[model samples]
Target: MDRRVLFATLILLAGGATGVGVALFAFVGVDDATTETTVVWESEPAAGDDGSGAAVATVDGDPLLLRPAVENGSRVVRATVAGGDETTWTVPISGPDAERGGGDANGSDGDPSGVSGLTTGTLGGDPVAALTTAPGELVVVDAADGTERFAVDIGGPGGLRPAIGDLTGDGTPEVAAVGTDGSVRVVDGEGDSVTEASLSGDIDRRPLVVEPDAEAGERGGIAVMTTTGDPATVHLLDETGEARWTTTPNVNPYSWNAADSRDGSVLVLGGTSGNIEAVETGDGSDRYEVGLQDLPVEVGDADPGTVYVGGSGSVWAVDLLDGEVVWKQQYGASTRINEPGVGDTDGDGELAPVVVNRAGEVLAMTQRGKVTARGGPDAVVYGGPLFADVTGDGGDEVIVVADDGTAIAADT
Candidate 1:
């Protein structure tokens, strides 16, 4: 029998015993046998919802899955745990009486508010959810109870995300947001602007906060990329909101957010430019550029020396130092892959990079780019995947949200 057919048959058999259905059509021609997977839990879709991405947060010493969505004509953040405890916090994106759009809500003509980013961080030593809403707003809520901690205008039409770091070297994390006007605003726990700096050209991506390295003699800084034109410029700002150095890379506006190399010595950037460029963090100089196909939607650090680039239908693991492609996995045409999350999803004491496509197919690949496991929500997925030990089993669970707003956690 064909290997693919045999793998599917085995999955069906295993799933049958659990009253679950396993379909491996997405890996029909793949050579490796699929690993057994179980759906740990599934949350119902929110009413009048489009989609959401999952972020893990610690609430009262417990890990919770945070899903930010525009549901039922309101912008809200939903928190859930593996044991099924859930809380929904309605965010006042505009105002209570302001027109909201989404789901089946009446009296709304505006488009549904887009969740540009969802991240968890500390605000004055308390856990908080920083949610960026479309059209320009950053709403911070208490992670434990969904209470509105604070909200600040991010200044722009939207699409910019926030980064959390210590801008004052005070041991407390501050929020950094880039306005469309090219200004980076560092806000404190009280929602006050700690410092504001400007970059040339308009900015749309999240600002990267680089921490100081004492041993490397590297002073930490904030990095922002310009998205107004080709050959985009990258600016590195100091702790005092001053520009240190700026370099232009052969990149375009249609790029994902840049990521810092493991040692914080190089910044890796990828996008529609069809290449990954590594910029030296010390002086903002180009280190190396590796060509790639397909437009990259996200870039993430895989291991110490390798970074994974996720694009349409494929993911590439490239060596950071030499710009060499270590391994590349292709998922065929018409598949849109989100940024992959790395963890030991199989609890084998070895880390693997897991990716989810728009078709809702989840694939966990070995460090060498071989598919080690295959599972999914079996629904259309619009958000990137998040890894966390939601089951408190000390093993990470891959969580993804479907287009209908259902959040699914699967264990392999």
Candidate 2:
């Protein structure tokens, strides 16, 4: 029997049990010959690891995992490799003594007041990280070293995270950040303002930077969604920060970030309204809308024809064209699934979606929704998992940060 089919049969035989145990049994089977996950390496508590999310970038031809944290009342980013070479950079936020809102200078209270999640971009053709040190301040630093490249005051509190893309058609990446004042600012690689635009409502998530399609005569733009209104507004902005089109899908304002379609023709988003929506990239027209049993919290990896979504204790693979659900798996009532990382985790030439829930259960499922591998740090997990070739083994490994700040890499 096919492995996916056999795994599905075992799941049904177990009365649809959910949790790490079920995933392990399904992955390893009742036979001892089945494969098991191996820990590649584990790092000590990344100093003040915020457990928000992480980004991977190539430094000196080596893959480095960048983890965000707060250290000694300062916003800092730490980079590490599979072999344990590490570097730390303290981001200088604009405040009195590097503290926000008159907080303790030592940051002993674990306050990440002014810092947002670390996002990898580029500055002057060198790989850099865009760190929001405060609401109005954005800083770019070299990813390989702790050197500051440039810093700019964005003029408002950056409420959500920022995204990086080439907005100026100049080949260098730009940073798109949404401010609490209902504005979007585009900054070039040199820390200069490329363009800025205003919206009618506040944004709850980072602006999505869409790439241009040369063959389609489509200049890529940014997709921003408002979180303050019903039937959330989706706006498509040109490179100059001009609105190309704006439409409100039947989605809640605080939905997961929109994802670009495989061909960059549509943007997919999942909302608390229990609707997964796909909108045309050019005209902001509705392409499809599908309903689900629970509210979706995260929109995961988007393949050519399908997209993965994680909702209240459930993960779903949905067809992009007609809003059809290819498959769905429920992880019981207690699990709160995070965003999933998609990759060829098992060296099988086929991509799989790997997810870690709040309870720190790492589960990797095949494209057909069969649970193939399971591993975890055995601690609470707040951030989502990331996949990268950290070991230089020509295969991707699952990298996750536990709530206690431990970073673990596992091979499936």
Candidate 3:
């Protein structure tokens, strides 16, 4: 099994927390030193009306997408699949501790003492999470059952979360977090510090993983953007937290998302300035730029050669080779769209654009940028909607959490 989810190949359910029934993989607390997982699922075609394919992307088989939902003081992973009748599951997370942060994800025989949940990621080739067990501590929790695998202290009062990936191409991913001090910290599996690279002045955005060349596999680097600098720098760091290249993207970037260029050789970043720039991965040289409007908040690739960028009122399909706006659509001034998730919403052989806004609006748009299926004000969405198939039912669904802690799964 590889460190990253084989989204390009197959979804492997090999490791997780210990649990039973309906096929699950779970884990125990770090203090308990127990590792196990139980999973039960049957692979079928992706879900849709005709059951032709799924609305969301998949590997060889269907894999559940984990969403952290908080209620009162308790947080759980809400796994859902949309189509026909919906299926859902929950895994409890551990909370704060006195001396050192520690607790079983199954709680007190299935309940915990805390209110927070884990951020989903891949650990040891299975679904896992990076959780903030304490104010200055980060813990790795198995997504299968919320068991703490290991805990590492990441000094932070600003509460910025960490990103995990196979930074070393060793089939074992590392946890990387940008501390409040504008430094990026790397932690290995056993809760040990691997590297701490400080390059920018005031880091404001999250760190994204980019492989300069998509074929680079786990050999790629992390992209960290800074809010305040002489020229607003974006540092591309190698596996050891070393800066491989740095570029000044913009002065006042409202929002930006990174995706692979069409040919998989460069990094294409879409910013709110309505500018999409492709930068060389080797030396941070200028490649090309495309201009689009409505503040392109989220950018991604569902196909190998096309990049989809969406905002509050518009979505554009850009050609990877020449940076041309191949297709586009606009909603309305009253509509607020942000990021996009890819799915075969209308059972099209190719993937389409799916987006949500702060108002909880969910829309599945066709390849030509027309609304196919419209649903929700389901959750007060501040970001792009997440797509997954949790029910083993085949079809893909949209997962959203409201401002009031309401978690809902809507059909795509």
Candidate 4:
């Protein structure tokens, strides 16, 4: 199916580890190398109380506003829609130290209490969709949003754009953004700049991906990507901004995607290997592996310990502790899912991989829609299941983009 997940789309599932035993796509047999299945899923309406709609926004006719942006001092700044109106709103990101860094997000060192004039932009051509942060500074506002929430100039003298990840596992996330000048910067949670490493003299180079280690002590560990001639190099960085480990493509790494298991193990996509590779988060050593005959469309971990793979119109669950296969499901053949993002949908006390499909029931103008709800096939239908209540409530609510360009919310 032309709908097979594509690497050019940057599909990434951000959690867990596991080996194979179960198959992900119904047709792919666990023991048969030639086995291939066409897995598809039923589409359901976006979850909400009345189905009238949830929160929504749009740039032109996009149907959804940019991803939610978390301002350092302000809560979560999301593009919101209500009663046929669209504008951004500040939903309090409640928690301890929520307002640690406040200033012009541009690093103007403006104010240290709050941010203002929040706006939007683009990163490496990818739309700066959203932003978030851990406990301290190292603010990660949507570079797309020009607002200053703990603004501190990054990327040498020209400033820079950064990607944020929970590198230290301190329960707090850090800024692991690549500089526009080809440097990598690691900043404190408080927006205080830390170490900046020169990536190479090539200004046109971009760090394909940056992810934190899952191991408790390896919280500050990071994984990065760079290009050499035509070959791409992937490097693992420690909390100290040192290159702890690096690797080259065995074949042709199409798109760079990385995620971590609870034990600090990492899974990387887009290597010459043509299969997903697992590596030690601490030293970036080779670990177990899995091969998706078709390039891995997307990868995610459900409970912080198992890795999930979606491709060839199916899903595969792998164990992180030992790389065992848990289960596999082939939902649809023609409906390929993209942007394999994960978060708990049913609020069943666990987060699962969520995807946008165009086959069975869920219908977005683009198969790149969204799936909320959890469980194998019986999970309760909830609204857009993105992240945890990241807002403040004990549980997270569903957020979805209605076809009419409005944001909708429903308690799960």
Candidate 5:
């Protein structure tokens, strides 16, 4: 997906809200509240080792805090509510392990409904915009002119921001937004209008957005995954808001997270079947699948090229041209990494580093945020070997949200 479209979709669906009813029933439909269960990973996630990373810096008045939601050999960090002169709530990450709360499809424990996961950061793009809070309350400004380009409100604290992309291949980017009520909204950038679809009841959490296929002279397509019961309902929606196909795959392995390469190849994370599968953008068919012992925390593709998969203190680089492992490295049997950012950090010829393995390898900002780099299996130099940027002034900066509501902009 284009970086711009990616960030826009994410911001629009930032908060978790109530659940709504939908007609698509692909997963195991759960009439009772979602059971909360603790997952015991055979292996634990390790914290990253620190190197001479970059410092934090700011562009306009708005500060940027670069905090990668490191993988969890340690514990899961729960976003906490920020108090005092703050508009947004900061999910707390201070516990020994990050907290995973089970709710209905919308991440709500069963109430009017609430926001699920809301974090501040950027995907892939120059001059990336950071989300202030969940979308229901916050509006995205141009930053340059502070012009209100978009205003978002989804009933309660709706923040299930959509993933931005050109699913229809229409140049005009669209956003896939989830409402506080389990309703999914596909907003067109050109029209600035929303087309919504809902199931019979609230679909647990927000729908996972994926561009399943792109046909020559054909409009692109999108996949929306919602909880049916134990299964996941994957709906294929075209740019015209028409449902073309639907699939109910048995994916009880892990919670679902997804990322796509530049060519539109899709990777589904956290499979219950203990594997990570890559699906072709052309068809929903599986390209390659890898066993995943640890929870699939985060997924990132390299500058529209390399496919970097990281988990349990290890990183693997996959070549998209052919579902082949470029290289896989173990930085340490013990360490933890967070939300990873991949791009061309150095002026080198190759694409940005797929995964940064070392702790200090990350480029740290003055504020102490990090930019990570790692070597691909087929790589020559220590791809990104390690570094960070603070200011984002021609360089990258780490945007870490402080314990308080204030966003910390560190130099990379």
Candidate 6:
């Protein structure tokens, strides 16, 4: 997906609201609560390491998406937040002297040059934005003026945005990031010290912010991937960065996108083990498993009982309710898919699954995965297709990011 759209998807789960309901479904879905998420307090997921990867949660209320881009020679946060007045802010991507929650920013650590991830959430009762920059730096910005507040020196650079939440049930939000060394670091919005917790394996993707449900009361924890064994492990960290429970599911999870089921009981997640499966979110137990005709790249739910999965050259609809293959269609477009957009691209009032390929191709398909509209650019697409009414012409447009960092909106 365009780095910005990817950030939006990945960052929306920053506050530990819930697993990306869609991805947990396939890669990331918007239905965490409905699927019945489990906190995984003490058990280890069943084990089997075969795995690959997937998408993130895109914010729904943001007026415009902000992507970090280049301007002149420095890195800038490019924003389309305003309808017309597009804005750019030059980020201080140099140096590592800002204090972290527990340490001073030292420039001698990891690559901390360019900004890679951008996400915003409320911290200390104020609007706060965070970026994971190259050379190992976590810079917290005040969204009001883009002022640099916290610049901590981490050792490795990752594009995963920090997940923010009230991890301690202290009525304030805290930001959590997976350390390059397989550790979880959490810093309160107002503190200067971090609560670092180590996991069993290396941290694979960004940690997921799981929200509290009726079953639990203190607060939900962060769901992080620690791939040490073959099937890998999913560790549930409580508010204080303590491991509450760990489980190894049947498949090794690759993509961070996990969608919640409609009943809010399970998560649909991508398994590199050549299968798409559902697991109990709270305990990491396998609920169901299904084979895949192609490697899945994007996953979501069209409706209850129906899950939409986009792969390298095909899309499949799995009937989790009945454990049957609803429909699977192949469209030889490219190698992988960005997040799929489900909307009425045909202007027929019927929703179609729109997928953007790495080749800059957009395909609008029917509910049964039948192709409808196909259009895109000549260059490589850097992000997934975003379905929006950019022109306000009563028609939806497929917006994609080019490899050159340009947002290209194509009409369906």
Among these predictions, the greatest TM-score belongs to: 2
Q: Give the distance in Å from residue 270's predicted Cα in candidate 2 to where it truly belongs.
A: 1.4
Question: Which of candidates 3 and 5 is the stronger one according to TM-score?
Answer: 3
Model 2's alpha-carbon lDDT is 0.66
Give the per-residue lDDT digits (tens) of candidate 6, residues 87-180: 4343545633322221101101122224444556778666767766544566677665556778775445444556676665556777777665
Distance (Å) between predicted and true CA of 193, model 2?
1.4
Q: What is the Cα-based TM-score of model 3?
A: 0.69
Candidate 2's TM-score: 0.83
TM-scores for every predicted model: 0.81, 0.83, 0.69, 0.54, 0.55, 0.67
Clashes of 3: 24
Model 3, span 200-231: residue lDDT tens: 47665556665333365424777777755654
Model 4 spans with C-alpha error above 4 angstroms: 1-78, 81-147, 156-161, 165-173, 201-219, 249-251, 254-263, 270-274, 358-412
- Please provide, for model 5 over 1-412, each residue's C-alpha lDDT reduced to its tens digit, 9 standing for 90 to 100: 2221111111111012222111111111111222221111111111221111111212343432222133444311222111112212112222232222343232212211122232222222212221212334323323222233454443333434345565655455555655544555665543254556664334334444554344533345656655664466666566665666665553342334455465565545435333445555454665555443344433444445455555556554445444344444444354433324454343243345433332323321110111232212111111122222433244433233222212322232
lDDT of 2 by residue, 46-162 (tens): 655456545777777777777766567665667777447455444444443232332211111233445666788666778887766445667777887757777777667662567
Off by over 4 Å in 2: 1-35, 47-49, 83-85, 88-112, 168-170, 258-264, 347-350
| TM-score, cand. 5 vs. native | 0.55
Error of 2 at 200 (Å): 2.4
Worst 10 residues of 4 by lDDT: 360-369
Q: List runs of model 3 lying over 4 Å from the truth.
A: 1-119, 131-134, 212-219, 294-296, 300-302, 344-350, 368-370, 390-393
Minimum summed lDDT over a 10-residue window in model 3 is located at: 46-55
* Alpha-carbon lDDT, every model: 0.65, 0.66, 0.51, 0.40, 0.36, 0.52
* Candidate 5: residue 313 Cα off by (Å): 1.6
For each of the candidates, the C-alpha root-mean-square deviation to the true structure, in angstroms, is 9.4, 6.7, 16.0, 13.4, 15.9, 13.1
The 10 consecutive residues of candidate 5 with the worst lDDT sum are: 20-29
TM-score of 1: 0.81
Winner of 2 and 4 under TM-score:
2
lDDT of 4 by residue, 5-106 (tens): 222322222222254122232222212221221112122232111111122223333323333233454444454422224444444433333232322222
Ranking by TM-score: 2, 1, 3, 6, 5, 4
Better of 3 and 4 by TM-score: 3
